[model samples]
Target: MKKLFLLGILSLFLCVLVGNVALGEEEKISIAYIGASTDLPFWITLRNEARNQANELGVEFIDLTPPSMDAQAQKNSFDNAIQMGVSGIIVGAADSRAFDDSLDKASEVGIPVVAVDTGIDHPHIASLVQTDNLSSAKIAGQYILDHMTRPGKVLIIGGVLGHQTGDARKNGVTEVLEAAGVEVIFRAADWLPEKAYEVAQNELAANPDLTAVFAAWDPGAMSAKSVVAERGLTGKIIIVGFDGDPANLKAIKEGEILATIKQDNVKMGRDSISLLVDIINGKEVPKYIPIDGFIIDQSNVDEFLQ
Candidate 1:
């Protein structure tokens, strides 16, 4: 009887040990998010949503954002995530073409990547989830064409011309304005609001009859607004921006900004993670996922204010 009791206790101990070993062997997914400056509300929304989605999916979430908008810094973050052996990576590239070598390394290690907001041109990139800036900018351009004064001189401020997101937005607006015989001028701020302000200031000073201004991002729009306000041309000029940042949305509501394009950031944030997870799990995903954008003006801005 004593021997049987000892045997039963040993069996129970062995079962518990095996259960712990099984639990220990189970793997948890880890996805790393590489993003640009969170200084902007757009990045903030995207990162938060990605983090939330990671939590819900029971995956380890790693957010690696550069301290500044420097391209090299973002590349370093990407490299770090790769070295950490993360299951996958999501990048919001500051420069679309900037990550080739790092992407090559990721491919060597068989880790897939998903790009958000800005698309990276690399085979290792499994998917790109972002707004359809080309189509959306057309909406803003059409709105500008319908509202601006005849014989209007419009200035289109944007980032570097080669950047996929900025180029698409700039081209969409420029094509429409040019087709309508509107005098369209472009200046690159290199994604800096201060530079955008300088451009707006110089242009406004040089061309007193400028009718409308189209900015590729909300900060650029706000910068133009500052210059316009400083020059007492607030009510005289029409201004529109992209990104639909919360602060900019408030500006639209308050009638400070005439009109702006609102990208579906919420969808972007959620879908980026969803796509990355799919790619990590050996599931196929569309190479290019385009989210839509719409115009928000005072007429419908109140709908978004809440």
Candidate 2:
């Protein structure tokens, strides 16, 4: 009887040890991603890529974006995610300053935050993983300068105003055009294709001599291109947009869009998550990780199309 009792006690201890080991192995790090509206195909792809990377790393990823590009809505999402007790967060801030308090709250809760696509001006962020927006925009802007024949007016379609990435891109284009002695008219469309279309249509109607249009994203640029074509200005006006979406590549092939800067969005997502994991594990992480981008134009669209 004594031997049987001892055996039962030893088995219970072994089971408890094994259970703990399994639980440790199953431990998952949860991350929240606050992005732009998922309706845009670019953002949809970004979300999916992040999800795939999370799955590979055995991490939990939560996507949060406003129905529209509303700063308050994005802040609310961040607050909710913080309350959910996530280990980390990745955000493409809707407004650079709007999320300051929410980011502060997250930091207070001991959660690490990384900025993707757009960046926060606060110092509490763990790292920033984004494309070199200004440089990439300059590349597209130079393409427009070289391709357009006349010195006529040009329209600059910007993303959600004050969003870091969009702002940088707009500034880059503006800088290049201003230096090249071109007239640049500015417009803001909140990063919506329909909005971009509406704005472009109005601009075209008001200024028929508009020789070029630069968009900060592919959807916006594509919208502008459609409007330009509808107005029978297809070959007359040059259209340049950022983000190498597959549709944009096709447009370049069709000679509608002049060029687009291709961001390695999947790599951005994967690298951001990997950095967060390392930071959580007390590993060193760079303060800034600037992902490089490429320019896809008629000259190189064939290589990227396939």
Candidate 3:
């Protein structure tokens, strides 16, 4: 009987020892990603890739997403991360400037910040990883020129007039179209979907003979697609978009959108984690990281299908 008791105690001690080992493995280096909401495909992919990269590096990833596009809520998330004293922070702020004071606080605490997609200028920012919006927009414009019907009337549904990303994309396409003597009408929708939808329908009503349409983002492309469908003119209008979002890919496969600029979001995500990890390890990181964008059309749409 004493032998049996001794054996059971030995098993219990072995189980406790194994449990401690597992607990030790659970708490490694921790990384936090505070960015846009992940309900949409683009943001979801970005956060997912970052999480995957974190896992690859054997670190914990904290994904903090605002309920929606509320700037206040996004700032609150930043505050929460700062309060938690995360090893590092990644910012995709709705309003980059809104975090001015909070960023200073983060800096005071020595938490390095990396901006992705949407840029926020500050001395404490370790790096900015984003798409080459201007050049990619130029590609879309040149595509319009390449496939444009002679004497074409093109509609450009642009982002907010003064915003950097929007302006870069708008300018890229406009520079190409205007220089080629293409008649273009520009509508600034301030990056709102409903606004884009309104602008699209109004322009189509006024100019039923549009040769092509260029949108700054994928949703805008979808908006244009829907508007064109409403008038039973899907294939009639050559549509191009930015942000190689999933729905837009399906649309391109179906022959609705002609093409879109596909940002290397996977690189952005992986690189974001890499940069922060480097910073945590006292390693140097590049100031500006630019990921190229490519055209997604029916010819290669199958290659990108999820």
Model 2 over residues 168-216: C-alpha lDDT tens digits? 8998888898898988999999887899999999999999779999998
Error of 1 at 304 (Å): 1.3
Every model: Cα RMSD to truth: 2.8, 2.7, 5.9
Quantify all predictions' global Cα lDDT against the true fold: 0.88, 0.86, 0.85
Candidate 3 pairs with clashing backbones: none
Runs of candidate 2 with Cα error greater than 4 angstroms are 1-26
Better of 1 and 2 by TM-score: 1
C-alpha lDDT of candidate 3 relative to the true structure: 0.85
Model 2, C-alpha of 220: deviation from truth (Å): 1.0
Instruction: Give Cα distance to truth, residue 1, candidate 1, Å.
Output: 17
What TM-score quantifies how close candidate 2 is to the native fold? 0.90
